[model samples]
Target: MLGRTPLDAPERQQEVFAAVLGVLAEVGYARFNMDLVAGRARASKASLYQRWPSKARLITDALKANLPELPQPDEGTFAEDVRQILLAWGEPTPFDTAGIFLGLLEGSRQDADLACLREEHVDRAYTEHLRVAVDRAKARGELPERLDADFLITALISTFVLRSEEQGVIEGIVDGLLRPLIGTFRAK
Candidate 1:
Protein backbone atom coordinates (compact mmCIF):
# COMPACT_ATOMS: atom_id res chain seq x y z
CA MET A 1 0.00 0.00 0.00
CA LEU A 2 2.93 2.38 0.58
CA GLY A 3 3.91 2.67 -3.06
CA ARG A 4 3.90 -0.75 -4.73
CA THR A 5 2.06 -4.07 -5.11
CA PRO A 6 1.08 -6.34 -2.22
CA LEU A 7 3.25 -9.25 -1.27
CA ASP A 8 1.47 -12.54 -0.66
CA ALA A 9 1.63 -13.92 2.90
CA PRO A 10 0.65 -13.15 6.49
CA GLU A 11 3.82 -11.18 7.06
CA ARG A 12 3.08 -8.91 4.14
CA GLN A 13 -0.46 -8.40 5.33
CA GLN A 14 0.92 -7.30 8.71
CA GLU A 15 3.10 -4.74 7.02
CA VAL A 16 0.15 -3.44 5.01
CA PHE A 17 -1.98 -3.29 8.13
CA ALA A 18 0.69 -1.45 10.03
CA ALA A 19 1.02 1.14 7.32
CA VAL A 20 -2.70 1.58 7.12
CA LEU A 21 -2.89 2.12 10.87
CA GLY A 22 -0.20 4.75 10.69
CA VAL A 23 -2.18 6.50 7.99
CA LEU A 24 -5.32 6.26 10.08
CA ALA A 25 -3.56 7.64 13.08
CA GLU A 26 -2.10 10.46 11.03
CA VAL A 27 -5.04 11.32 8.77
CA GLY A 28 -8.10 10.19 10.67
CA TYR A 29 -11.04 8.71 8.76
CA ALA A 30 -12.50 11.99 7.47
CA ARG A 31 -9.33 12.64 5.50
CA PHE A 32 -8.36 9.05 4.69
CA ASN A 33 -7.89 7.99 1.08
CA MET A 34 -7.31 4.62 -0.50
CA ASP A 35 -4.57 6.03 -2.65
CA LEU A 36 -2.77 7.29 0.43
CA VAL A 37 -3.21 3.97 2.15
CA ALA A 38 -1.89 2.24 -0.95
CA GLY A 39 1.06 4.59 -1.02
CA ARG A 40 1.75 3.98 2.64
CA ALA A 41 1.48 0.21 2.38
CA ARG A 42 3.31 0.16 -0.95
CA ALA A 43 0.50 -2.01 -2.24
CA SER A 44 -1.24 -1.93 -5.59
CA LYS A 45 -4.58 -0.14 -5.69
CA ALA A 46 -5.96 -3.09 -7.64
CA SER A 47 -5.08 -5.55 -4.90
CA LEU A 48 -7.22 -3.65 -2.41
CA TYR A 49 -10.23 -3.71 -4.68
CA GLN A 50 -9.65 -7.38 -5.46
CA ARG A 51 -9.37 -8.30 -1.81
CA TRP A 52 -11.80 -5.94 -0.05
CA PRO A 53 -14.15 -4.51 -2.70
CA SER A 54 -14.56 -1.09 -0.99
CA LYS A 55 -12.87 1.46 1.21
CA ALA A 56 -15.29 0.64 4.02
CA ARG A 57 -14.44 -3.05 3.93
CA LEU A 58 -10.72 -2.43 3.76
CA ILE A 59 -10.86 -0.03 6.71
CA THR A 60 -13.18 -2.31 8.66
CA ASP A 61 -10.77 -5.18 8.16
CA ALA A 62 -7.99 -2.92 9.36
CA LEU A 63 -9.90 -1.93 12.48
CA LYS A 64 -10.61 -5.57 13.26
CA ALA A 65 -6.97 -6.41 12.78
CA ASN A 66 -5.85 -3.71 15.19
CA LEU A 67 -8.16 -4.80 17.99
CA PRO A 68 -7.98 -8.08 19.87
CA GLU A 69 -10.94 -10.37 19.54
CA LEU A 70 -13.09 -10.93 22.59
CA PRO A 71 -12.41 -14.30 24.11
CA GLN A 72 -14.96 -17.03 23.58
CA PRO A 73 -16.79 -17.40 26.84
CA ASP A 74 -17.64 -20.90 27.83
CA GLU A 75 -16.10 -19.82 31.09
CA GLY A 76 -19.03 -20.83 33.32
CA THR A 77 -19.79 -17.16 34.10
CA PHE A 78 -20.73 -14.49 31.58
CA ALA A 79 -19.66 -11.60 33.79
CA GLU A 80 -16.07 -12.77 33.95
CA ASP A 81 -15.68 -13.05 30.19
CA VAL A 82 -17.70 -9.89 29.60
CA ARG A 83 -15.52 -8.11 32.11
CA GLN A 84 -12.36 -9.26 30.34
CA ILE A 85 -13.51 -8.22 26.87
CA LEU A 86 -15.01 -4.95 28.08
CA LEU A 87 -11.88 -4.15 30.02
CA ALA A 88 -9.74 -4.89 27.00
CA TRP A 89 -12.05 -2.74 24.94
CA GLY A 90 -11.84 -0.03 27.56
CA GLU A 91 -8.08 -0.10 27.43
CA PRO A 92 -8.02 1.01 23.83
CA THR A 93 -8.93 4.50 22.68
CA PRO A 94 -12.59 3.98 21.86
CA PHE A 95 -12.71 7.03 19.66
CA ASP A 96 -9.95 5.53 17.55
CA THR A 97 -12.51 3.09 16.17
CA ALA A 98 -15.11 5.75 15.35
CA GLY A 99 -14.02 6.36 11.79
CA ILE A 100 -14.02 2.76 10.63
CA PHE A 101 -17.18 1.92 12.52
CA LEU A 102 -18.96 4.97 11.14
CA GLY A 103 -17.72 4.21 7.64
CA LEU A 104 -19.12 0.70 7.82
CA LEU A 105 -22.40 2.09 9.16
CA GLU A 106 -22.64 4.47 6.22
CA GLY A 107 -21.72 1.76 3.72
CA SER A 108 -24.25 -0.61 5.25
CA ARG A 109 -26.82 2.02 4.42
CA GLN A 110 -25.88 1.60 0.76
CA ASP A 111 -24.17 -1.51 -0.67
CA ALA A 112 -25.22 -5.05 0.23
CA ASP A 113 -21.60 -6.21 0.15
CA LEU A 114 -20.72 -3.48 2.61
CA ALA A 115 -23.85 -4.19 4.59
CA CYS A 116 -23.11 -7.91 4.76
CA LEU A 117 -19.60 -7.23 5.93
CA ARG A 118 -20.86 -4.79 8.54
CA GLU A 119 -23.57 -7.15 9.73
CA GLU A 120 -21.39 -10.21 9.93
CA HIS A 121 -18.12 -8.71 11.02
CA VAL A 122 -19.18 -5.64 12.97
CA ASP A 123 -22.69 -5.87 14.38
CA ARG A 124 -22.83 -9.61 14.75
CA ALA A 125 -19.30 -9.79 16.01
CA TYR A 126 -19.87 -7.23 18.77
CA THR A 127 -23.19 -8.81 19.60
CA GLU A 128 -21.65 -12.23 19.90
CA HIS A 129 -19.20 -10.96 22.48
CA LEU A 130 -22.07 -9.60 24.51
CA ARG A 131 -24.04 -12.80 23.90
CA VAL A 132 -21.20 -14.83 25.30
CA ALA A 133 -21.26 -12.53 28.31
CA VAL A 134 -25.00 -12.90 28.70
CA ASP A 135 -24.85 -16.64 28.20
CA ARG A 136 -22.39 -16.80 31.02
CA ALA A 137 -24.87 -15.06 33.29
CA LYS A 138 -27.57 -17.45 32.16
CA ALA A 139 -25.29 -20.36 32.90
CA ARG A 140 -24.47 -18.95 36.30
CA GLY A 141 -28.15 -18.53 37.23
CA GLU A 142 -27.61 -14.78 37.30
CA LEU A 143 -30.03 -13.77 34.57
CA PRO A 144 -33.76 -13.98 34.42
CA GLU A 145 -35.25 -16.84 32.39
CA ARG A 146 -36.93 -14.43 29.96
CA LEU A 147 -34.14 -11.86 29.62
CA ASP A 148 -33.78 -10.41 26.13
CA ALA A 149 -30.18 -10.87 25.16
CA ASP A 150 -30.12 -8.53 22.19
CA PHE A 151 -31.92 -5.77 24.04
CA LEU A 152 -29.60 -6.06 26.98
CA ILE A 153 -26.51 -6.03 24.82
CA THR A 154 -27.80 -3.15 22.72
CA ALA A 155 -28.61 -1.15 25.81
CA LEU A 156 -25.17 -1.74 27.26
CA ILE A 157 -23.51 -0.72 24.01
CA SER A 158 -25.74 2.31 23.74
CA THR A 159 -24.80 3.59 27.17
CA PHE A 160 -21.16 4.01 26.26
CA VAL A 161 -21.77 5.04 22.67
CA LEU A 162 -24.41 7.60 23.57
CA ARG A 163 -22.26 9.35 26.09
CA SER A 164 -18.91 8.66 24.47
CA GLU A 165 -18.54 12.04 22.81
CA GLU A 166 -19.19 13.90 26.04
CA GLN A 167 -17.87 11.46 28.61
CA GLY A 168 -14.93 9.90 26.80
CA VAL A 169 -13.80 6.30 27.41
CA ILE A 170 -11.38 6.98 30.26
CA GLU A 171 -10.58 3.45 31.33
CA GLY A 172 -13.18 2.47 33.95
CA ILE A 173 -16.00 4.74 32.80
CA VAL A 174 -17.62 2.26 30.39
CA ASP A 175 -17.26 -0.73 32.66
CA GLY A 176 -18.24 1.31 35.69
CA LEU A 177 -21.45 2.47 34.07
CA LEU A 178 -22.08 -1.06 32.76
CA ARG A 179 -21.24 -3.22 35.76
CA PRO A 180 -24.20 -1.87 37.73
CA LEU A 181 -26.56 -3.02 34.97
CA ILE A 182 -24.82 -6.36 34.70
CA GLY A 183 -25.35 -6.84 38.39
CA THR A 184 -29.06 -6.22 38.03
CA PHE A 185 -29.81 -8.46 35.00
CA ARG A 186 -31.41 -11.39 36.74
CA ALA A 187 -33.64 -14.12 35.28
CA LYS A 188 -37.28 -13.39 35.92
Candidate 2:
Protein backbone atom coordinates (compact mmCIF):
# COMPACT_ATOMS: atom_id res chain seq x y z
CA MET A 1 0.00 0.00 0.00
CA LEU A 2 1.36 3.38 -1.01
CA GLY A 3 -1.41 5.96 -0.63
CA ARG A 4 -4.14 5.99 1.97
CA THR A 5 -6.95 7.69 0.04
CA PRO A 6 -9.32 5.40 -1.88
CA LEU A 7 -9.93 5.78 -5.58
CA ASP A 8 -13.10 7.90 -5.88
CA ALA A 9 -13.19 8.88 -9.51
CA PRO A 10 -15.04 6.79 -12.10
CA GLU A 11 -12.32 7.60 -14.66
CA ARG A 12 -9.67 6.44 -12.22
CA GLN A 13 -11.58 3.25 -11.53
CA GLN A 14 -11.89 2.55 -15.24
CA GLU A 15 -8.21 3.29 -15.73
CA VAL A 16 -7.19 0.98 -12.91
CA PHE A 17 -9.56 -1.72 -14.12
CA ALA A 18 -8.24 -1.59 -17.69
CA ALA A 19 -4.68 -1.76 -16.41
CA VAL A 20 -5.59 -4.67 -14.18
CA LEU A 21 -7.14 -6.57 -17.09
CA GLY A 22 -4.19 -5.89 -19.36
CA VAL A 23 -1.70 -6.96 -16.70
CA LEU A 24 -3.69 -10.02 -15.73
CA ALA A 25 -3.84 -11.00 -19.38
CA GLU A 26 -0.09 -10.60 -19.50
CA VAL A 27 1.29 -12.12 -16.22
CA GLY A 28 -1.75 -14.05 -14.95
CA TYR A 29 -3.26 -14.13 -11.45
CA ALA A 30 -0.41 -15.76 -9.53
CA ARG A 31 2.02 -13.06 -10.65
CA PHE A 32 -0.52 -10.20 -10.61
CA ASN A 33 0.07 -7.64 -7.87
CA MET A 34 -1.34 -4.33 -6.68
CA ASP A 35 1.96 -2.52 -7.16
CA LEU A 36 2.06 -3.39 -10.85
CA VAL A 37 -1.58 -2.44 -11.33
CA ALA A 38 -1.08 0.80 -9.43
CA GLY A 39 1.93 1.70 -11.53
CA ARG A 40 0.16 0.82 -14.74
CA ALA A 41 -2.99 2.61 -13.64
CA ARG A 42 -0.90 5.54 -12.42
CA ALA A 43 -2.66 5.28 -9.07
CA SER A 44 -1.34 4.17 -5.71
CA LYS A 45 -1.13 0.65 -4.31
CA ALA A 46 -2.87 1.89 -1.19
CA SER A 47 -5.68 3.23 -3.31
CA LEU A 48 -6.17 -0.19 -4.87
CA TYR A 49 -6.22 -1.86 -1.46
CA GLN A 50 -8.37 0.82 0.05
CA ARG A 51 -10.94 0.29 -2.66
CA TRP A 52 -10.90 -3.48 -3.21
CA PRO A 53 -9.16 -4.81 -0.06
CA SER A 54 -7.37 -7.69 -1.88
CA LYS A 55 -5.96 -8.66 -5.27
CA ALA A 56 -8.65 -11.26 -5.79
CA ARG A 57 -11.43 -8.78 -5.02
CA LEU A 58 -9.92 -6.18 -7.29
CA ILE A 59 -9.35 -8.59 -10.16
CA THR A 60 -12.75 -10.17 -9.90
CA ASP A 61 -14.59 -6.86 -9.74
CA ALA A 62 -12.60 -5.50 -12.64
CA LEU A 63 -13.42 -8.53 -14.73
CA LYS A 64 -17.05 -8.37 -13.73
CA ALA A 65 -17.31 -4.69 -14.56
CA ASN A 66 -15.82 -5.23 -17.99
CA LEU A 67 -18.09 -8.12 -18.85
CA PRO A 68 -20.76 -7.39 -21.44
CA GLU A 69 -24.39 -7.61 -20.42
CA LEU A 70 -26.12 -10.82 -21.47
CA PRO A 71 -29.20 -10.67 -23.67
CA GLN A 72 -32.66 -10.44 -22.17
CA PRO A 73 -34.76 -13.56 -22.57
CA ASP A 74 -37.01 -13.45 -25.62
CA GLU A 75 -40.72 -14.24 -25.38
CA GLY A 76 -40.70 -15.75 -28.85
CA THR A 77 -40.46 -19.46 -29.64
CA PHE A 78 -37.92 -21.42 -27.65
CA ALA A 79 -35.78 -21.98 -30.71
CA GLU A 80 -35.59 -18.27 -31.51
CA ASP A 81 -34.89 -17.34 -27.90
CA VAL A 82 -32.12 -19.91 -27.51
CA ARG A 83 -30.64 -19.08 -30.88
CA GLN A 84 -30.57 -15.36 -30.17
CA ILE A 85 -29.14 -15.80 -26.71
CA LEU A 86 -26.48 -18.32 -27.70
CA LEU A 87 -25.55 -16.78 -31.04
CA ALA A 88 -24.81 -13.45 -29.40
CA TRP A 89 -21.47 -15.00 -28.44
CA GLY A 90 -20.47 -15.17 -32.09
CA GLU A 91 -20.55 -11.40 -32.41
CA PRO A 92 -17.28 -9.75 -31.36
CA THR A 93 -17.05 -6.94 -28.84
CA PRO A 94 -14.26 -4.66 -27.63
CA PHE A 95 -14.74 -6.21 -24.22
CA ASP A 96 -13.71 -9.64 -25.42
CA THR A 97 -11.52 -10.69 -22.52
CA ALA A 98 -11.74 -14.41 -23.23
CA GLY A 99 -8.05 -14.86 -22.45
CA ILE A 100 -8.46 -13.19 -19.11
CA PHE A 101 -11.68 -15.12 -18.54
CA LEU A 102 -9.88 -18.42 -19.20
CA GLY A 103 -6.92 -17.49 -17.07
CA LEU A 104 -9.15 -16.63 -14.14
CA LEU A 105 -11.18 -19.79 -14.67
CA GLU A 106 -8.02 -21.86 -14.35
CA GLY A 107 -6.79 -19.84 -11.41
CA SER A 108 -10.17 -20.12 -9.69
CA ARG A 109 -9.55 -23.85 -9.33
CA GLN A 110 -6.69 -23.15 -6.92
CA ASP A 111 -7.85 -19.90 -5.30
CA ALA A 112 -10.94 -20.21 -3.20
CA ASP A 113 -11.54 -16.48 -2.86
CA LEU A 114 -11.30 -15.96 -6.59
CA ALA A 115 -13.58 -18.92 -7.15
CA CYS A 116 -16.14 -17.48 -4.74
CA LEU A 117 -15.92 -14.12 -6.42
CA ARG A 118 -16.53 -15.69 -9.82
CA GLU A 119 -19.41 -17.77 -8.51
CA GLU A 120 -21.01 -14.78 -6.85
CA HIS A 121 -20.62 -12.33 -9.66
CA VAL A 122 -20.13 -13.75 -13.17
CA ASP A 123 -21.50 -17.29 -12.98
CA ARG A 124 -24.50 -16.55 -10.79
CA ALA A 125 -25.72 -13.65 -12.87
CA TYR A 126 -25.44 -15.58 -16.14
CA THR A 127 -27.04 -18.62 -14.60
CA GLU A 128 -29.99 -16.59 -13.41
CA HIS A 129 -30.41 -15.04 -16.84
CA LEU A 130 -30.30 -18.43 -18.53
CA ARG A 131 -32.64 -19.86 -15.94
CA VAL A 132 -35.18 -17.16 -16.63
CA ALA A 133 -35.10 -17.90 -20.33
CA VAL A 134 -35.56 -21.60 -19.83
CA ASP A 135 -38.27 -21.08 -17.25
CA ARG A 136 -40.08 -18.73 -19.55
CA ALA A 137 -39.99 -21.22 -22.38
CA LYS A 138 -41.28 -23.91 -20.11
CA ALA A 139 -44.10 -21.70 -18.85
CA ARG A 140 -45.15 -20.99 -22.42
CA GLY A 141 -45.27 -24.70 -23.18
CA GLU A 142 -42.30 -24.33 -25.53
CA LEU A 143 -40.02 -26.49 -23.39
CA PRO A 144 -40.73 -29.57 -21.32
CA GLU A 145 -42.21 -28.54 -17.99
CA ARG A 146 -40.06 -30.97 -16.01
CA LEU A 147 -36.71 -29.96 -17.52
CA ASP A 148 -33.91 -28.68 -15.33
CA ALA A 149 -33.27 -25.06 -16.18
CA ASP A 150 -30.04 -25.08 -14.20
CA PHE A 151 -28.67 -28.05 -16.12
CA LEU A 152 -29.62 -26.56 -19.45
CA ILE A 153 -28.08 -23.25 -18.47
CA THR A 154 -24.93 -24.99 -17.28
CA ALA A 155 -24.66 -26.97 -20.48
CA LEU A 156 -25.17 -23.87 -22.61
CA ILE A 157 -22.65 -21.89 -20.54
CA SER A 158 -20.00 -24.62 -20.47
CA THR A 159 -20.42 -25.28 -24.17
CA PHE A 160 -19.70 -21.68 -25.08
CA VAL A 161 -17.14 -20.89 -22.40
CA LEU A 162 -15.05 -23.99 -23.12
CA ARG A 163 -15.09 -23.49 -26.87
CA SER A 164 -12.71 -24.36 -29.72
CA GLU A 165 -11.05 -21.89 -32.10
CA GLU A 166 -13.36 -22.51 -35.00
CA GLN A 167 -15.92 -19.81 -35.76
CA GLY A 168 -19.57 -20.83 -35.12
CA VAL A 169 -18.32 -23.87 -33.19
CA ILE A 170 -20.00 -22.67 -30.03
CA GLU A 171 -23.17 -21.79 -31.89
CA GLY A 172 -23.31 -25.18 -33.51
CA ILE A 173 -22.67 -26.97 -30.26
CA VAL A 174 -25.22 -24.90 -28.34
CA ASP A 175 -27.85 -25.38 -31.06
CA GLY A 176 -27.20 -29.13 -31.27
CA LEU A 177 -27.36 -29.50 -27.51
CA LEU A 178 -30.38 -27.26 -26.97
CA ARG A 179 -32.56 -28.33 -29.91
CA PRO A 180 -32.97 -31.81 -28.49
CA LEU A 181 -34.12 -30.28 -25.27
CA ILE A 182 -36.53 -28.18 -27.33
CA GLY A 183 -37.79 -31.33 -29.01
CA THR A 184 -38.63 -32.69 -25.60
CA PHE A 185 -40.90 -29.67 -25.07
CA ARG A 186 -44.70 -30.09 -24.88
CA ALA A 187 -46.89 -28.14 -27.29
CA LYS A 188 -48.88 -25.20 -26.01
Candidate 3:
Protein backbone atom coordinates (compact mmCIF):
# COMPACT_ATOMS: atom_id res chain seq x y z
CA MET A 1 0.00 0.00 0.00
CA LEU A 2 1.22 3.51 -0.85
CA GLY A 3 1.20 6.39 1.63
CA ARG A 4 -0.83 9.53 0.92
CA THR A 5 2.06 11.89 1.59
CA PRO A 6 1.48 14.03 -1.47
CA LEU A 7 -2.19 14.47 -0.64
CA ASP A 8 -1.43 15.45 2.93
CA ALA A 9 0.56 18.61 2.17
CA PRO A 10 -0.90 21.67 0.41
CA GLU A 11 2.45 22.52 -1.18
CA ARG A 12 2.76 18.93 -2.37
CA GLN A 13 -0.71 19.13 -3.88
CA GLN A 14 0.28 22.33 -5.71
CA GLU A 15 3.36 20.57 -7.04
CA VAL A 16 1.17 17.70 -8.19
CA PHE A 17 -1.19 20.14 -9.90
CA ALA A 18 1.74 21.80 -11.69
CA ALA A 19 2.96 18.36 -12.74
CA VAL A 20 -0.49 17.53 -14.03
CA LEU A 21 -0.50 20.69 -16.15
CA GLY A 22 2.99 19.98 -17.41
CA VAL A 23 2.03 16.48 -18.43
CA LEU A 24 -1.20 17.76 -19.94
CA ALA A 25 0.65 20.37 -22.00
CA GLU A 26 3.10 17.80 -23.28
CA VAL A 27 0.90 14.78 -24.01
CA GLY A 28 -2.58 16.42 -23.93
CA TYR A 29 -5.78 15.08 -22.36
CA ALA A 30 -6.24 12.08 -24.64
CA ARG A 31 -2.93 10.59 -23.60
CA PHE A 32 -2.77 11.97 -20.03
CA ASN A 33 -2.48 9.36 -17.30
CA MET A 34 -1.70 8.99 -13.62
CA ASP A 35 1.62 7.37 -14.39
CA LEU A 36 2.86 10.40 -16.29
CA VAL A 37 1.68 12.80 -13.59
CA ALA A 38 3.26 10.69 -10.89
CA GLY A 39 6.52 10.56 -12.82
CA ARG A 40 6.54 14.32 -13.24
CA ALA A 41 5.40 15.08 -9.70
CA ARG A 42 7.63 12.47 -8.08
CA ALA A 43 4.61 11.10 -6.28
CA SER A 44 3.24 7.58 -6.22
CA LYS A 45 0.52 6.67 -8.72
CA ALA A 46 -1.45 5.07 -5.93
CA SER A 47 -1.35 8.33 -4.00
CA LEU A 48 -2.65 10.32 -6.96
CA TYR A 49 -5.38 7.77 -7.61
CA GLN A 50 -6.27 7.82 -3.95
CA ARG A 51 -6.87 11.57 -4.12
CA TRP A 52 -8.48 11.83 -7.56
CA PRO A 53 -10.17 8.67 -8.80
CA SER A 54 -10.71 9.75 -12.42
CA LYS A 55 -8.60 11.58 -14.98
CA ALA A 56 -11.40 14.12 -15.48
CA ARG A 57 -11.57 14.90 -11.78
CA LEU A 58 -7.81 15.32 -11.48
CA ILE A 59 -7.46 17.47 -14.55
CA THR A 60 -10.40 19.66 -13.65
CA ASP A 61 -9.06 20.24 -10.15
CA ALA A 62 -5.63 21.00 -11.51
CA LEU A 63 -6.99 23.50 -13.99
CA LYS A 64 -9.11 25.15 -11.34
CA ALA A 65 -6.16 25.44 -9.01
CA ASN A 66 -4.06 27.04 -11.71
CA LEU A 67 -6.64 29.58 -12.88
CA PRO A 68 -5.76 33.24 -12.20
CA GLU A 69 -7.78 35.07 -9.60
CA LEU A 70 -10.22 37.19 -11.56
CA PRO A 71 -11.00 40.64 -10.23
CA GLN A 72 -14.57 41.75 -9.57
CA PRO A 73 -14.42 45.50 -9.90
CA ASP A 74 -17.52 47.64 -9.72
CA GLU A 75 -16.36 50.67 -11.65
CA GLY A 76 -18.93 53.49 -11.81
CA THR A 77 -19.64 52.79 -15.49
CA PHE A 78 -20.31 49.49 -17.23
CA ALA A 79 -17.68 50.28 -19.82
CA GLU A 80 -15.04 50.89 -17.18
CA ASP A 81 -16.06 47.70 -15.37
CA VAL A 82 -15.67 45.74 -18.57
CA ARG A 83 -12.32 47.36 -19.27
CA GLN A 84 -11.02 46.38 -15.85
CA ILE A 85 -12.31 42.83 -16.22
CA LEU A 86 -10.80 42.36 -19.66
CA LEU A 87 -7.44 43.82 -18.65
CA ALA A 88 -7.27 41.46 -15.68
CA TRP A 89 -8.37 38.53 -17.80
CA GLY A 90 -5.76 39.36 -20.40
CA GLU A 91 -2.92 39.33 -17.89
CA PRO A 92 -0.45 36.55 -18.75
CA THR A 93 -0.28 33.46 -16.61
CA PRO A 94 2.79 31.54 -15.48
CA PHE A 95 1.77 28.60 -17.63
CA ASP A 96 0.53 28.10 -21.17
CA THR A 97 -3.15 28.94 -20.82
CA ALA A 98 -3.91 28.45 -24.52
CA GLY A 99 -2.41 24.97 -24.48
CA ILE A 100 -4.47 24.02 -21.45
CA PHE A 101 -7.61 25.41 -23.05
CA LEU A 102 -6.97 23.40 -26.22
CA GLY A 103 -6.37 20.26 -24.18
CA LEU A 104 -9.58 20.82 -22.25
CA LEU A 105 -11.51 21.47 -25.44
CA GLU A 106 -10.33 18.19 -26.90
CA GLY A 107 -10.89 16.31 -23.65
CA SER A 108 -14.36 17.71 -23.17
CA ARG A 109 -15.36 16.32 -26.59
CA GLN A 110 -14.44 12.76 -25.61
CA ASP A 111 -15.20 12.75 -21.87
CA ALA A 112 -18.65 13.61 -20.61
CA ASP A 113 -17.21 14.03 -17.14
CA LEU A 114 -14.67 16.50 -18.42
CA ALA A 115 -17.35 18.39 -20.32
CA CYS A 116 -19.47 18.68 -17.20
CA LEU A 117 -16.47 19.68 -15.12
CA ARG A 118 -15.43 22.27 -17.66
CA GLU A 119 -18.90 23.79 -17.58
CA GLU A 120 -19.15 23.73 -13.82
CA HIS A 121 -15.64 24.92 -12.95
CA VAL A 122 -14.02 26.52 -15.97
CA ASP A 123 -16.90 28.14 -17.86
CA ARG A 124 -18.66 29.32 -14.71
CA ALA A 125 -15.49 31.06 -13.50
CA TYR A 126 -15.50 33.38 -16.48
CA THR A 127 -19.25 33.70 -17.02
CA GLU A 128 -20.30 34.31 -13.42
CA HIS A 129 -18.17 37.46 -13.08
CA LEU A 130 -19.40 38.74 -16.41
CA ARG A 131 -22.98 37.98 -15.43
CA VAL A 132 -22.67 40.07 -12.29
CA ALA A 133 -21.21 42.95 -14.28
CA VAL A 134 -23.99 42.70 -16.85
CA ASP A 135 -26.64 42.60 -14.14
CA ARG A 136 -25.23 45.76 -12.58
CA ALA A 137 -25.27 47.43 -15.98
CA LYS A 138 -28.86 46.38 -16.52
CA ALA A 139 -29.88 47.79 -13.15
CA ARG A 140 -28.18 51.07 -14.07
CA GLY A 141 -30.08 51.26 -17.40
CA GLU A 142 -26.85 50.96 -19.34
CA LEU A 143 -28.04 47.96 -21.32
CA PRO A 144 -31.21 47.52 -23.38
CA GLU A 145 -34.13 45.87 -21.65
CA ARG A 146 -34.18 43.16 -24.30
CA LEU A 147 -30.44 42.59 -24.44
CA ASP A 148 -29.22 38.97 -24.55
CA ALA A 149 -26.76 38.85 -21.66
CA ASP A 150 -25.57 35.36 -22.47
CA PHE A 151 -24.77 36.21 -26.08
CA LEU A 152 -22.92 39.36 -25.06
CA ILE A 153 -20.96 37.56 -22.38
CA THR A 154 -20.03 34.79 -24.76
CA ALA A 155 -18.85 37.25 -27.36
CA LEU A 156 -16.67 39.12 -24.85
CA ILE A 157 -15.11 35.96 -23.42
CA SER A 158 -14.54 34.43 -26.85
CA THR A 159 -12.88 37.59 -28.08
CA PHE A 160 -10.57 37.78 -25.06
CA VAL A 161 -9.64 34.12 -25.22
CA LEU A 162 -8.86 34.29 -28.95
CA ARG A 163 -7.00 37.59 -29.14
CA SER A 164 -5.50 38.12 -25.70
CA GLU A 165 -1.95 37.55 -26.95
CA GLU A 166 -1.80 40.65 -29.12
CA GLN A 167 -0.55 43.86 -27.54
CA GLY A 168 -3.34 46.41 -26.88
CA VAL A 169 -5.88 43.73 -27.87
CA ILE A 170 -7.97 44.11 -24.74
CA GLU A 171 -8.16 47.88 -25.18
CA GLY A 172 -9.14 47.48 -28.84
CA ILE A 173 -11.76 44.88 -27.97
CA VAL A 174 -13.20 47.15 -25.30
CA ASP A 175 -13.07 50.47 -27.17
CA GLY A 176 -13.28 49.36 -30.78
CA LEU A 177 -15.54 46.32 -30.66
CA LEU A 178 -17.50 46.05 -27.41
CA ARG A 179 -18.16 49.74 -26.86
CA PRO A 180 -19.75 50.07 -30.30
CA LEU A 181 -21.64 46.82 -29.89
CA ILE A 182 -22.98 47.94 -26.52
CA GLY A 183 -23.86 51.37 -27.96
CA THR A 184 -26.03 49.66 -30.53
CA PHE A 185 -27.92 47.88 -27.75
CA ARG A 186 -28.11 50.78 -25.33
CA ALA A 187 -31.57 52.20 -24.57
CA LYS A 188 -32.28 54.95 -27.09
- Measured by TM-score, the strongest candidate is 3
- The clash count for each model shown is 17, 1, 0
CA lDDT, every prediction?
Answer: 0.63, 0.73, 0.83
Question: Which candidate number has the best lDDT?
Answer: 3
TM-score of each predicted structure versus truth: 0.65, 0.77, 0.87
Q: Which structure is stronger by TM-score: 2 or 3?
A: 3
lDDT by residue for model 2 (1-188), tens:
43333466676677788888888877777888898998998787776787888888998888787766678767476666766666665567454355676668777987999999988987776676677777788788777777777777777776676673467765586467656656655433
Q: Write model 3 residue lDDT over 1-188, tens digit each, in one string.
A: 23446476888888889988888777789999999998888888888888899999999998898777889999977788889988777776766666677788889999999999989988998888889899998898888767899998988887777666778877887789767867887735
Local error of candidate 3 at 51, Å?
Answer: 1.3
Return the lDDT, model 3, position 105: 80
Reference-based lDDT, residue 55, model 1: 68
Question: Considering only N, C-alpha and C atoms within 3 Å, which residue pairs clash in candidate 3?
Answer: none
- Evaluated at residue 179, the lDDT of candidate 2 is 62
Give candidate 1's TM-score: 0.65
Candidate 2 wrong stretches, greater than 4 Å: 1-6, 87-91, 184-188
